[model samples]
Target: MIMSHLPYLISAYGITLLTVLALWLTTYRRFHQAKNKLDIMKKLNHET
Candidate 1:
């Protein structure tokens, strides 16, 4: 019955959610790091 499968469904959804969150956070962090690096490079170029 549906009730018997509830635990499996809940775990599957939870795992999927966590995976998406981890991927999002990783992408966000990398984007900021790349942006900072770009800014630093631009400043160096301007100084020269």
Candidate 2:
């Protein structure tokens, strides 16, 4: 029956979720870093 494969299915889904979360976190961090750098540059430009 389908019950026999339940564990494998669960593990597969867990791995997929983890992978997606990791990718999202990486992209989010990079975006914030870039935004911060841009803000700093703008502030410096306006000081002249």
Candidate 3:
């Protein structure tokens, strides 16, 4: 019955959410690191 499949559907939804969150965290970390490097470079350029 369709009602019996509710647990499977819920599990799938949880897995999908975890995957998306992991991907987002990885992307955010890379973006922050890149921004940090840019800031350092800008500071160095101004000093010269």
Candidate 4:
């Protein structure tokens, strides 16, 4: 049975989780940065 490979399975799942979390954080940061730039541009455009 797969029970014999329990350690390997757990490690695989852990690596996958960390990868997803890293990807989510990177995307979230980029989105906020882009939004801030856009807001600044909009404000400048309105002032002109």
Candidate 5:
């Protein structure tokens, strides 16, 4: 019964978890990069 489909279930859950984690890491990196760029731009503007 359920035992027959156990492997399929486990793989599906593993794929979904990996996708969510990759997306989170990408978003986190992009956010910090954008913040750093913004800070640099502000400093340049202040210098003028």
Candidate 6:
């Protein structure tokens, strides 16, 4: 494949992909942490 503006295209694609991956990781980490906390809370509540 030939791109007339290879530098610009490469930068754009790299940035876009990185941004998406970062957002996905942030959301996934928050969700996982929240779920872990919720499970711990539930366990504590059950024991009491």
Candidate 4: tens digits of C-alpha lDDT, residues 1-48: 789899999999999999999999999999999999999999999999
Name the regions of candidate 2 deviating beyond 4 angstroms.
none
**Cα error of candidate 1 at position 7, Å:** 0.9
lDDT of 1 by residue, 1-48 (tens): 999999999999999999999999999999999999999999999999
TM-score, prediction 4? 0.87
Q: Candidate 1: misplaced stretches above 4 Å?
A: none
Model 3 ranges off by over 4 Å? none
Give me the displacement of residue 31 in model 6, in angstroms. Answer: 0.1
Per-model TM-score on C-alpha atoms: 0.93, 0.93, 0.87, 0.87, 0.86, 0.87
Clash totals for all candidate models = 0, 0, 0, 0, 0, 0
For candidate 2, list the clashing residue pairs, or say none.
none
The lDDT values for all models are 1.00, 0.99, 0.99, 0.99, 0.99, 0.96
**Predicted candidate 6 versus true structure: per-residue lDDT over 1-48, tens digit per residue:** 467689889999999999999999999999999999999999999999
Candidate 4 ranges with C-alpha deviation above 4 Å: none
Instruction: Name the runs in model 5 displaced over 4 angstroms.
Output: none
Location of the lowest summed lDDT over 10 successive residues in candidate 3:
1-10
RMSD of each: 0.6, 0.7, 0.9, 1.1, 0.9, 2.1
Worst 10 residues of 1 by lDDT: 1-10
Better of 1 and 2 by lDDT: 1
Q: Residue 31: error of model 1 in Å?
A: 1.0
* Residue 20 error, candidate 3, Å: 0.4
lDDT score, candidate 3: 0.99
Model 2 local distance difference test score: 0.99
lDDT of 5: 0.99
Question: Which candidate's lDDT is highest?
Answer: 1
Q: In model 6, which regions exceed 4 Å deviation?
A: none
